[model samples]
Target: MNYVLYAVPFFFLLIGLELLADRWRKVSTYRLADAINSLSAGVLSTTVGLLTKVVGLLTYTFAWQHWGVFELSAQNLWVWLFAFVFYDFCYYWNHRLGHERNVLWAAHSVHHQSEEYNLSTALRQTSTGWIFGWVFYLPMALVGVPPLVFLTVAALNLLYQFWVHTRHIPKLGWFEWVFISPSNHRVHHAQNAVYMDRNYGGVFIVWDRLFGTFQEELDEEPVVFGVTTPLASWNPLWANLQFYVVLWRDAVLAESWWDKLRIWFMRTGWRPADVAAKYPQSKADLSQFVKFHVPLRPAQQLYAGLQFVLYVAAGSFLLATGANQSVAVLLGSCAWMAFGLYVLGLWLENRPQALGLEVLRLLLNAPALWLAEQAGLLPISTLGWSLLGLYSLASALALVLVARRGSAALPA
Candidate 1:
C-alpha cells in the first residue's frame, strides 16, 4: 500500500489548520516562497524516490529471504508490535548518523535548509538518503521481519512525525518525556549549539533519552531554526546538492589523497587543513542571523502560486501511477518536473532572468504535453491540447505583466 500517497490530502488539511492557528495567535510561521521551496523539495524527493526506493526494498527483501536468522511471520500480532518499536530504533541511528557524518549530512541537510518551523516543513525531506540509510535497518531484516511489515511500520513512523513540525503546539508536559512531541521535535530542528544534533528519535523520544542525545526545549534559549550555514537560495535542486558540492570541492582541493578520500566519512564539518586555510567558510553568528528572503511583488507571488498549483496537481498524478511506469517514461516526467521547479525557484528568488526562464517554460508546455501524450503518460484529448495551448499563451502574457509591474516597483 502506498501509505504516503494516501496521506497527502490530510497533510495539506493540517497545514491549513496550522495557518489558521498562526492567524489566531498573530504569528507569522510561514513565508510563501519558503513554504513553496520546502514543498518543492518534498515533491522532488517523492518523485526521485519512485526511482530510488527499490535499492533499499530489494536489499531488505533479499536479506530477509536468504539469510534471516528467524522466520518472523507478518500475520503475528506481536511481530507487528515488535517491528513498530524496532523500526524507530533503527531510524534513531539512521537519523543520528545523518547529522554526524559528512557524506550523510550532504543528503540529509535539505530538511534543515528551511528557516521556518511549520507543517509544510514536515514534508521537506532528503532525496539521496536511500544511498546509505538502508543499511541501518539491516538488523530488522536479519531478525526476519517480513518486507511488508517493515514497509508498513516505516510508513507509520514517518506519518506519526508529520504533526511534530509545527510551532503552534506547546510542550505537553509528560508527553515530551515519552513520545516525540512538537516541542522536543522543534529542538531537533534547532541549530543552536545546545540543540544541535540532538533528539534523533522518530516516533518515540525514549531512544533519544536512553542514548543521551535528548535536549529539552528551553525557554531561556529560544530555538533558532535552520542550519548554521544557511541555504540562501529558494532552489530545491540547490538545496539538495549544496552540501554535497561543498564536500566535493573540499575533497578536490585537499593536498593529500588520504584527506581527499577520508573527508567524506569524517565528522560532519571536518575539512582538510590545506583546503580550510585557503578557503575558509564561517558559520553564521546566531545573534546576527537573518532569514533568507527575496520579496516577490503581489503579482509575482500570484503567478508563482498559480503555477505551483498546476505542478502539484501533475505531481500527484505521477505519484499515484509512478510504480507502474516504465523507467524511460518516469525519467522523462521527472526531468520536466525538475525543470519546472528550477524555473519556479528563479521566480521566487526574483532573479532578473526569471521572466525569460518562465517564458521558456511556458513555451515548452506544448511540446511537453505532446511528448507526454505520445508516451501515454498523459491521455490528453484534442480539447485538452487546446486548453494547454490556451494556458501557455495566457501564462506568457501574465509573466510579461508581472515583469512590468516588478520593474515599475523598482527604483530608477
Candidate 2:
C-alpha cells in the first residue's frame, strides 16, 4: 500500500511545525546544511531502495512460502495484533546488531551522523541496509505471518518512530516505562559513555528492558548527540561510505590474514592489534566537539535552498512513477539525482570550486531536461520546459550576483 510513500507530505509538515516550535521556544535545533544533508541521504536511500528492496521482499516471501509453521490469516484481528508486537521484537535485534557489529554499523551509522537530533535526523537512513537486514526478520515469515500483515506492521512501526525523534516532547512518566518515548529514544541517539548502545526497540521499550539494553535519560548527564567518530562533512555519498572506508583500510593494513578477514564481522570498533599499534587512531575529545559548518552569504543560502527544492520535486515525481518507468529511464533519473545531490553537498561545504561546479550544473539543465523528456521520464509540455528554462536562467543569474558579492560578506 506504499504507506511510507503516502506519509511523505505529513513528515515535511511536522518538520515545518517543529521549526515553528523552535521559534516559539527560543531554541535552535536545526542547521540548514546539516538538515539538507540528512534529507539528501534519505532521498538517496529511498531512490536506491526502489532498486534494492526486491532483496528483502523476495527473501521474506520465500521463507514464508517454504517454511511456514502455522497458517495465519490476515482477516484475523489476533494476527494483526501478534505481528505488530513480533515485528518490533525482531526490529530490536536488527537495530541492536546494527550497532554492535562492524559491517552493520557501517550502514546504520548514517542515521546517527547528524549532531542535531530532529525529525530530519529520522530521515537520515542508509541505502545499503538491504545487504544483510533481511536475515533478521525471517522469524516472522517462518511463523506464517502473511506478507501483507508484515508489510503493514513494519510501516506502522516506522511511522510510530517519527514523532519520537523530537526534543519538544518531555518524558511521559508511566508511558516511558513500556513504549518507546522521546526521552528514551534520545538516550538511544546519545554517544555518551552511559548512553552508547542502549535502548534499541522500535516501538516497544519493553524489549530493551527485557534484553538489558535499556538506559533511562538522566537529568544529571545531558545528552550529547552524534557518534564518537564525527562525520565531518556535508556530503551524503561520503556519509554512507565513511565507516565502510575506515573498515576497509583497517583490513588492508592488518598483518594477519585472520584479523583481516574477521575485522568486518568483529565488534563495532575492534581493530587489529598490529594496525592499532602501528597507526594509532586518536579518540575524539567530547568536550571540544563542534558541529560541522561552512560559511555562506544570505544570497548563496537562498540559491542553494531553491535549487534543493527543485531536486526534491523531481525526486518525488520519480518515486511516485518509478514502477512504470523503463529500467534505463529509472537508472538515468537516479544517476542524475545523485549527481545533483553531490553537487549540492559541495555547495553547502562552500568549496572554492563550488561556484564553477554550480555554473556547470545550471548549464546542464537544458540537455538534462531534454534527455529526460526524450526518455519519457518527464512528459513536459512547452510551458513546463519554458518554466524550467526560466528557473535555470534565474539560478545562473543568482549565482553570478552572489559571486560578485565576494567572500567578504557575513556568513549565513
* Number of the top-ranking candidate, with TM-score as the measure: 1
Q: Which residue pairs show collisions in model 2?
A: none
Instruction: List, residue by residue over 67-128, the lDDT tens digit for candidate 1.
Output: 99999998899999999999999999999999999999999999998999999999999889
Residues 1-412 of candidate 2: C-alpha lDDT, one tens digit per residue: 7888888899999999999999999999998889999999988988887787778889999999999899999999999999999999999999999999999999999999999999999988998998999999999999999999999999999999999999999999999889999999999999899999999999999999888999999999888999998998988999999999999999999999999999999999999999999989887777787777787777778888888888777767777888787777777777877888889999988888877888888888888888988988788899998898788878878887888786546486
* Each model's lDDT: 0.92, 0.90
List ranges where model 2 is wrong by over 4 Å: 407-412
Clashes of 2: 0
Give the per-residue Cα lDDT of candidate 2 at 36. Answer: 92
- Model 2, TM vs. native: 0.97
The candidate 1 region of ten consecutive residues with least summed lDDT is: 399-408
TM-score of each candidate structure, all chains considered together: 0.98, 0.97
Per-candidate RMSD, Å = 1.1, 1.9
Best model number under lDDT: 1
For all candidates, what are the clash counts?
Answer: 0, 0
